[model samples]
Target: MPSFYSKKDLFFQLFENQNCLELTQLPYFSDHSKETFTLVLEAAEQIAEKSLYPIFREMDRQEPQLVDGKIRIHPAMGTIIRKFGEDGWINAIFPYEEGGQQLPWVIHLAAGFIFQASNYSASVFPFLTTGAANLIRTFGSKELKEKFTPKMFAGKWQGTMALTEPDAGSSLSDLTTTATPASISGVYRIKGQKIYISAGDHDACENIIHLMLARIEGAPSGTKGISLFVVPKIRLDGAPNDVLTQGIYHKMGYKGAPIAHLMMGSQEECEGYLVGEAHQGLKYMFQMMNEARLGVGMNAVAIATAAFQASLAYAKERPQGRKISEKDLSKPQVPIIEHSDVKRMLLFQKSVTEGALALLIYCGILSDKIAQETSAAKKLKMEALLDLLTPIAKSYPSEMGVKSTSMAVQVLGGAGYTTDFPVEQYFRESRIHPIHEGTTGIHGLDLLGRKVWLQEGLGWKTLQQEIQHSLDQVKSIQELNDLGHSFEEIFLKFNHSAGELLFKRNLGPEKFLADATLFLEASGILCVGWMWIKQAISAQKAISSGALEQSFYLGKIETARYFMEYELVKILGLIPRFHAASYPTVTMEKDWF
Candidate 1:
């Protein structure tokens, strides 16, 4: 089988570009070293190659089905989940007292990327459990944690974030799910339906645990009223909990994982255990949502990286037409990689996947730093920066990954259009990321309408300082001075445009957010540009120090150059739209459509 991802690129992003090992210096992570991290990655790779990749196509071809009220998935997922638990992956990043390794989040994300690239459909099962168990460990009562996490960590039960109701897809305040106090303390009767729930009702485990959102009876209206619950498919007494799987969604791609539509209290017997304080569910769920947002970004990069690998392999081995200058019909055709256009396409994929990977890993490192920092002031600053970048990290990779996977298909020509290749499936899977965790448009609004001005613009100022520091470092390197200068110019222009937009906040909500998506696109491009500049600086230093793989380092610099010239320049087109006086998209009548 062809390689699905680049280990060299992953290691380069983790160690050289991001300096992930520096995280080990933190007292919280002092038990670990670079060797331990490498071993974790190797273990993930072994499982992915042996259990997941070989069944990638089979799972897609034969999707989950709702049979007699139970959703049955591929038989292999049960074993996969068990192995993940047996190997401690489910609790790897938790505290040692919690039966975890005190692993840094960055290392965990790196190991996850390998599984994601190998088989994204199968990969969701265990990670969802991790996120759910984490929510319990963080906010649930001692009884809740002790009861749920042990089985969850053991892979005996599945976990899911049950938030999206039919009416409350993105608007959580409008959720209709209701929770009433039961006869027992700390337990409520949950009576609502949830839809589009991933890993909601798979037969891979003995039980399904949903970290769900519901509104308490007589609670305040809007977001303040929301509450979270731990609702299970099977009660602790070994009896059914009255949670029903109404139906399973058949999707375009990512068919291997089931998306469930559920009914909670058809018999009025569903029981839910409260998590944390009442009416504070949204606050707690944001923790999981933000983490999943980054995971979604990595998911995009992983799928695109896999597609790029498939296309690269095809391009190198599949001989095609000769160069345009070749007039001799007798000359043997050359591999498609020899063509300039194909090379351009490949470079675009590389630049996007690698650049986005760098940004996500940077965010992960920030998370680790925030968790371990001793100084209150520095921790607050890191939190602000992370808040600022969360939406960008989540949306950029998702939106661009679709285009990157499409380019992979284009490189393979007609072969990519057929099922004979994985690129097409990758193309389908890529579409979900933009819509998952929150749609791109939603994040666009959140970025411009909320995140930019968060903590009185602390995140905004901190990000500028961070970028400037990188630029300052790059400028000292003679070989990268010009590229650094180019990025600085665009960076200033982007800030100017963003400043103008922020000033428009006084105009009204609609006017301010009318072009928020455009602002998001420009910001994404600029942020990726910053990541590439950092990468270029790393590559230049490695070359100067006599790195062994000369071509790999050289390619990093070239990809950075290509991004600055081609991708970063696109921001210019968006700057003018920010200055426009008229607002058509906001004012246009709906009937006109």
Candidate 2:
């Protein structure tokens, strides 16, 4: 019961330093203020600690079960859902007219981190529901929104995105699900099996709304012909829809939320309403997918944050051998935290988790700016920035969260490996994130294959320009000059490396993308390096102003420095890997493996 997550001071200071409240000037958030943001965060924290945190272990211990084809989750989850729904955290970013708080995306994300850090499994249903509902609100017809959005937003119903199938996995082009036109104007009969669906079914709500993907019969093959649909578990006429729970998947982590295999139209009665025009399901779903990717990044950070705190606390109290310089035979043992190696491990976790959090929070702020900006050009530029950052934002944190939590385990030695501490659970849960939104492989392809080159490389260029602006701000700070210059070289190297890939495009797409994952890994490291530098600048400003929380500000600066000196240098190893003309992966024969 030692505090797993109690970092309100650091969290709030990040919000203030990031200028999250500046979004209030926009009409969408005009009614809100700093006070409103704090109120919502407190409400979320109250629910997280009072309701969710207390039962996190129990929920994990007793994973959801499939009883007579009905999935039964932890009983405690129902209360958490109700409390969040009532408090509007379930729909915090929805428009006010739609019964939401109309809070800025950054603040909403901050609140989400609180709950996720406290108990991600309990918090996941609402997160899935919010993303599903947002897709409907953005693209669904009036009838669809009116019937579904309110119920979902009110927490009377749950929502899920149904995209993955038995064979498709991440390849939407291969999905075999089919839809046929129904007599109703917008309705279609859905017939497909979606696997690994989170919150796919549960008894905590009156209904489960599935934002599903399928192909119309005889539609063109691959992703182009696919379409999106609103498939409900229960039909409007009060009978069960043809959606059947084939089985509930037991996972190593995130055990509280059921991962289900679902069969739609098994009884040939599954009715689905299309969200938009045909052959646009992938396009529409990509929006939700991107949102989910962002969520994945945040979830990874939250879990790692908890692991770091637990390990840090234990390190401070656990007595071990004397320091390297000490004659240990004659003296009492010092805390493990005083040991250089233990501190190094903890610092690695701290740097990665904190830097990842700052990067994702910055993405959230850009998300709000994109929503509120009036100028079409500015909006387009903001969109490009988001496009470029999304892959790194999703992959870096996820991939590193696994590494960070593993270090947390190393910090505690034996206890970290056992259920006596939650670090092991954190480690298990963090592994799924890289595979969840899109595998690191897929994201790397997206980054190097498409996002970086899309719109004539506008996204890549815009991101570099912004990073340069941050470095510019630190020029007059003599102490940061050398680090700022080092980051500049890092940026130039990334830009040049990307240019090399673009130049090699004529060699064949296969060769061009041969080391795409390595490219992504390199980019992720550099992007996070940029974030740490920005945080350092923010901390420096606070320190100069003689902030009351001097220790907090000092900690931020030191963490930033640690990341730059230790983690950021990783990009050097990948640079040569990026330059290889013939990747061994593509050269190996199929029989070799």
Each model's lDDT comes to 0.94, 0.85
- Residue-level lDDT of model 2, residues 40-105, one tens digit each, is 777777877788889888888999999998899998777668766777877888877788878787
lDDT of 1 by residue, 167-280 (tens): 999999899999999999989999999999999998899999999999999999999999999999999999999899999999999999999999999899999999999999
Q: In candidate 1, residue 569 scores what lDDT?
A: 94
Residue 309, candidate 2: C-alpha displacement in angstroms: 0.7
Worst 10 residues of 2 by lDDT: 8-17
**How high a TM-score does candidate 2 get?**
0.97
What is the C-alpha local distance difference test score of candidate 1? 0.94
Q: What is the lDDT of residue 478 in candidate 2?
A: 82
State the weakest 10-residue window (summed lDDT) of model 1: 1-10
